[model samples]
Target: MADVVLQTINLTKEFTKRKGLSSPRHFFDKVTFTAVRDVDLTVERGEIFGLLGPNGAGKTTLTKMLCTLMLPSGGSATINGYDIVRQQNQVKRSIALISSEERSFYWRLTGRENLKFFAALYGLSGRAARSRIDEVLELIGMAAAADRRFQEYSTGMKQRMALARGLLADPEIFFMDEPTKGLDPVATRQLHDFIRDELVRQGKTVVLATHHLAEAEQVCDRIGIMSNGEMKACGCVSDLVGEASLIEYFHLLIEESRLEQ
Candidate 1:
């Protein structure tokens, strides 16, 4: 069996709905709404596992929980066999996050300067960090722009820089949320190729959360369809999309979700 990069058991999150000050107050006024309910899932090592859902479908929330950004209200999770809650540091050390809304860096600094700062934080400091910074800048094709100020870089260039920083830690797993969200067509395709290459060549696992069905279908080894705080179906690309187009499969799953509510 493949190693488990990430796993969740009966994972759940609840938000307490607070009543308005002007509204009638009662003991039952405050209610709990589960954002993720009793979710049990596993992601295998070296596999690109996609989580697909519409807006407000709990994809982001679930990712947050897996990355230890938010505490789970119930159940448990482990990253690379280390408990996410009990062994937060070990979990963090094993994974890297590449957010679509990449963090802004000092615009005055060079592209390579930003990556060096991140590399140092990952404890890859001094000569080694400097060398790795150069390596990643080249690996991501940012070497040509390495000495240029980040403010002068284009949107796609900045996105590539952010991704380079994510890889600086030499992480075993990557959590990428809508990685190609704002890129142009060419940039998006370049990024898609890079993601695939990482899995096929470098043997890293990924948790990819995106609304793009076709992209998910093309890249994922397995996919889980989530809606309304639950997983509707999960399997290989063809297994779930078999005998139907991806668009049709998505609609069918979504319609089933509505019927449940």
Candidate 2:
């Protein structure tokens, strides 16, 4: 049997939006927005599972819930056999999150310095931290440039540094949200190759939340198509698209979701 590293059952998230703070009646009245609804999925160890969706489609929301960054309003999930809610710390220890936000790092710090700081947060210090930081820097092909300030690096280099930081924990699973968001074509392809050739080779499962259809088809072993905060379809690219192009099928799924709503 395949080792299921991550699983979710009816996992959902809802946010309450208040109409107006000025009015007493409006204060009591709230509109609920379901960011993710009844999302059921499974990701096996060492396989790339893509959450393919456009912005506001709840891919990031779901990823956040799984990473234990945000609490789920309903349902449940597990990471590496630990419940995400009850065993939050264990779940966090087993997973690393890499987001597209470039501002999360200290701009004044050099790449190696940034990694060293984060490594301390993960409880690594002294020679161990240095050795691990060196390993990940080399793994991300940032060894030579590790001493450069983060603000001076190119967009692609910044993203690679983010990847390096994620690897510091040496977690079993990685949650990457729009990792290739601002990259040009060449950079995006290079990142994709690094994900497939390097990360997977290290026996890590990746939960990639991305809007890029081509990226999903190329990097994912299996995909879950999410629209309007729900999973519309899931399977291998060949199975999900069949005779139709992935773009065509994606549009079809979105339209069908709209009609259902």
Candidate 3:
């Protein structure tokens, strides 16, 4: 039996846009834009599931809903068998979020210092926190640079630090949103290897949202292609790309989706 770790049923998110206050109609009228619509997704344990989409495709919205950062306007989801809506705390405990946002960290703080602070937020302290921080630093191959100020670190090192922070809690699942954004090709490849070689080795399930089709093909075990708030296609890489390059197939699906819209 396959162990399912994440599941979503008709997951949807909508944002309301109102006109300016100068217009009388603003008070009475609103436009509803659906960011994610009826997205049914399933991710199995210990597998890297990629959410591949272009901008405005709702990949980030879907991830946010699953992470409990944004409440779904409709439908439901569960992480590690815990309801994302009803059991918010439990859902949070079961997963970690990693993004390529360097501003989330204090510039002056050393990498180790930053991890320690985040560890405290995770309810770990003293020897337990220290041990975990050390473990993650080594795991991300940043033990030597742990004491360097975050601002001094290269983009790749910063990304590794972000991964280290995510691993602090040892969550069963990781939700990464454009984690390799702004990284060079070499750095991106290195990050991909770390995710596959080290993170998967620990039996962790990863949900990666990225615009890089090549990265998705290289890293993800299975991928779901999203377009205009809907899942356009999904399956194993080899199965989906049979007889055609992934780039060609990806463009075909995206073009077909545009025509339907």
Candidate 4:
């Protein structure tokens, strides 16, 4: 009975190696790699939740499942209390998905052109979509470069543009994975400001997945650390950190995970 925007119940995903030269043809090797397993995560309404972990800790996989990019092998999840497996369409509409340097959008198109296309897809057309695009551009300080080709845009600009696409739908939930991955300190600060200020001010729920424990500690009201497809702990920064400084706390958190079998 939690006022949660996102929740997962024993969620799991498993992949099998298809070894071509194995004994069996189309070898379905008994080897099972669990990318994510038995994870129980909850994001409260109007809070920025952090999914903290190192690379290959399955943060991206978890984000993808939440955003409906992939199906989990077991358990159930809900977005806005709409079952992800059942009411997927509704879930998709309410969720904004962003990732770092993976699948994105038209590099050939101008920044404005790109936003226009997504706005149309989200059913915002003509004046309404234009208005929204302008709003986000101004919010992200990309108004001046709105007409520039995405290929010519800086890394930070591209990140902001990807974020704008997510906002075009006016979604209530945002799933961002390593959003500030390749940016410099200044750009990272700017992106952090948007997530911490703009998103929170609007009462949006965010689930941020990143390796930067320092930033996560600063922004997340609560954090969950994962390793080898399982979550180690989940709680507020002060709750987990206790006497240690934020930097000291992150090392302790990581060390705790590494100690687990």
Candidate 5:
């Protein structure tokens, strides 16, 4: 059997609804939304696994639950054999989340300063933090602009900084949500190359959540297609594609999901 680095067994998340603050029964109101339901998935060590879904497909919510950033309503997960709920700290230490959102960083801080600050949060300090920060800057090809303020950097550079922050802890698994969102084709290709050539080569297991079928096909070893809070299909890229193109296969699965619902 492959070395499974991440596994979720029927993991589920539901949010209870509340009425307006003026209503007396608002506190008692209990409508609910199931964002993720019975999601059973496995990611092998040192492979890029893609979770492909449209917007609001519960990809982010599932990621948050696995990362221990959000609590699951049912089921459980393990990261490198550590239970996510019972061993939250161990799970957190073993993974990193790279989101496309640039607002997560302090706009006033320089690229290096932002990285240094985040590195400090991960417990590295002084010379050690500086060394790691420098190494990451070089890794992302941002050494030349390390001193530039974050707001001054273009969208591509900001994305690189986000990647740097995620790499500061040197986690074993990386969870990336739409890493190339809103990027020009050139920038997107650059990020894709970095991910495959550098990160994968360095032996990190990556779990990528993206809506771009072609990009996922290019980078993922295996992919799970999610729709409306459920996984419709999962397999190696070739298996998933077969005679159909990835986009065609994706649309077929999505249509099937709609009919099932």
Candidate 6:
């Protein structure tokens, strides 16, 4: 087996109810919501692993926990051998998260400027930052619109630019949450090709969290299906689903689960 670049053992997250301003405590009355529940997963180096689920199935929450954007309420995870909590700095340095949310970027800055700024955060300066920024923009096919104000860019363009920013640090592990959310067919195919080709050539491990079953089957080496904050099934597309498409397998599994419930 290839080296495990990312792993999570019983990883979980819980969101407690907010407390109103009161003299006495509301901890007893607080309701806890489990966003992710005991998710165990592994990703090998240079592999494309797809995390597939319907919306609100805890896909994004699991990614956030692995990437260190949000702390896991319980259990543990490691990225490139660094603990997500104790070794946060090392974990952060080794991974990049490309979320679908466009609001994370500075709307006033041009696409190039945004990359440059984020590159600086990773300690790249002077020629190093400029070169890296340009390289990523070209890779994402955003070079022509690199100077356009982010706010003025189309939704697809903004998503592309966000992807460029995520690669600025050249991290070992890439976590993408619905990366092709706003892209057209051509752009989506292009992004998928780039991810499977260029990034794979570089031996980067990608954890793609998306609900697109066909897209996952096309690009991922292995797929893990999630539902109601739990992992339902996991394996290679060929072995797990056989001749049937992923959608068919997924529906079968969902129906089985519903019957059990």
Highest TM-score against the true fold, candidate: 2
TM-score ranking from best candidate downward: 2, 3, 5, 1, 4, 6
lDDT of 3 by residue, 109-193 (tens): 9999999999999989999999999999988889999999999999889999999999999999999999999999988988899
lDDT (10s digit) by residue, model 5, range 22-78: 467666676788889999999999999999987778889998888999989998899
Q: Which portions of model 2 show Cα errors greater than 4 Å?
A: 21-27, 243-245, 253-261
Candidate 1: where are CA atoms >4 Å away?
21-28, 243-246, 252-261
lDDT of 4 by residue, 138-234 (tens): 8888999999988998888899899988888889999989898889999889888888999999999999998888888888899988877888778
The predicted structure with the larger TM-score, 1 or 3, is 3
Q: How many clashes show up per model?
A: 0, 0, 0, 0, 0, 0
Computed on alpha carbons, the lDDT of every model, listed in order, comes to: 0.85, 0.91, 0.91, 0.87, 0.89, 0.87
Off by over 4 Å in 6: 18-28, 243-245, 252-261
Q: What is the lDDT of residue 183 in candidate 1?
A: 91
Q: Name the lDDT of candidate 4.
A: 0.87
By lDDT rank, best first, the candidates go 2, 3, 5, 6, 4, 1
TM-score of each: 0.91, 0.94, 0.93, 0.91, 0.92, 0.90
> What TM-score does candidate 3 get on C-alpha atoms?
0.93
Q: Which window of 10 residues has the lowest lDDT sum in candidate 3? A: 19-28
Report the lDDT tens digits of candidate 6 across residue range 24-67.
Answer: 47734766788899989988999999999877778999998887
The digit string of per-residue lDDT tens for model 2 on 1-261 reads 989999999999999877677577778788888999999999999999999986678998999899888999999999999999999999989999999999989999999999999999998999999999999998889999999999999999999999999999899999999999999999899989988998889889999999889899999999999998999888887787785577987877667666756
Off by over 4 Å in 3: 21-27, 243-246, 252-261
